[model samples]
Target: MSEQNASAAVNIDITRIMEMIPHRYPILLVDRILEFVPNERAVGLKNVTFNEPHFQGHFPRFPVMPGVLIVEAMAQTAAIMVVQTLGKEAEGKLVYFMTIDEARFRKPVVPGDSLHIHVQKTKQRGPVWKFKGEAMVGDTLCAEAEFSAMIMDN
Candidate 1:
């Protein structure tokens, strides 16, 4: 994708998202990319449900989405943006988390909640990129964090 095209709003479905990232099955937290602006930012959506594997062990009577998983969803959103910015050549590359700072969980995310993950690039050098992300359910802020990741050939 060119700079011109990158600037335009883009919607990525589950199939395309699968091609860009390696996460799958129960771990593929992001269900779709609602909007993507290459190097700038991306907004992804995850539809939480009771059928998720974690809910069985996380809490049987009162299921709640794990905080760590929420952060992972944010990271996944960032990774998708990174891959889109780098183009097809970087597809299937591995993005490993280097650091997670100032992470906070404000509200419990339950099943039926639509998690909107907003991630913006803060800094980038070589293959390492820093991002600030927020997980929101409608207008409610559920969680947020600042993190960095290194993208490398798989």
Candidate 2:
């Protein structure tokens, strides 16, 4: 990230994340925001655990966090960036997926991994925004995708 961008980002915890988005419990994939720079980019955290609901059937013997959920986590992080950019104007609005592209899983995200999600804005036209994202476990890449979402009235 450039110095100009870095200067604008602010860190947020789970309590503030809950205040920013509507997800909760097992569905709230993001644990924290390490960097959030309004319209530019965001970095999120997810501490994977064995107790997650997906582990029950995702694989009985060897469990792995589903690739789709990782994408969702990235999307949620991007959604927070959008909300943070828009401030109070974003309240009561919902971020809905419009498209997902170039999605790939480089490595399986397993239990006890700490997922670091990085998302950057590609474009924004009206209520629709496009973003590219990567999910990683430390320095190892776990998954990546480019997706679009429409922020609409809830």
Q: Which candidate ranks first by TM-score, i.e. highest?
A: 2
> Clashing pairs in model 1?
none
By lDDT, the best candidate is 1
Q: Please list the C-alpha lDDT of all candidates, in the order they appear.
A: 0.95, 0.92
Residue-level lDDT of model 1, residues 63-141, one tens digit each, is 9999999999999999999999999999989999999999999999999999999999999999999999999999999
Candidate 2, residues 56-150, lDDT tens digits: the string is 99998999999999999999999998998899889668999999999999999999899999999999999999999999999999999999999
Model 1 scores worst on lDDT over the 10 consecutive residues at 2-11
lDDT of 2 at 121: 97
Regions more than 4 Å wrong, model 2: 1-3, 7-9
Query: Over all chains combined, what TM-score does candidate 1 have?
Result: 0.94
Please, what is the TM-score per model?
Answer: 0.94, 0.95
Q: Which stretches of candidate 1 lie over 4 Å from their true place?
A: 1-8
Give candidate 2's TM-score: 0.95
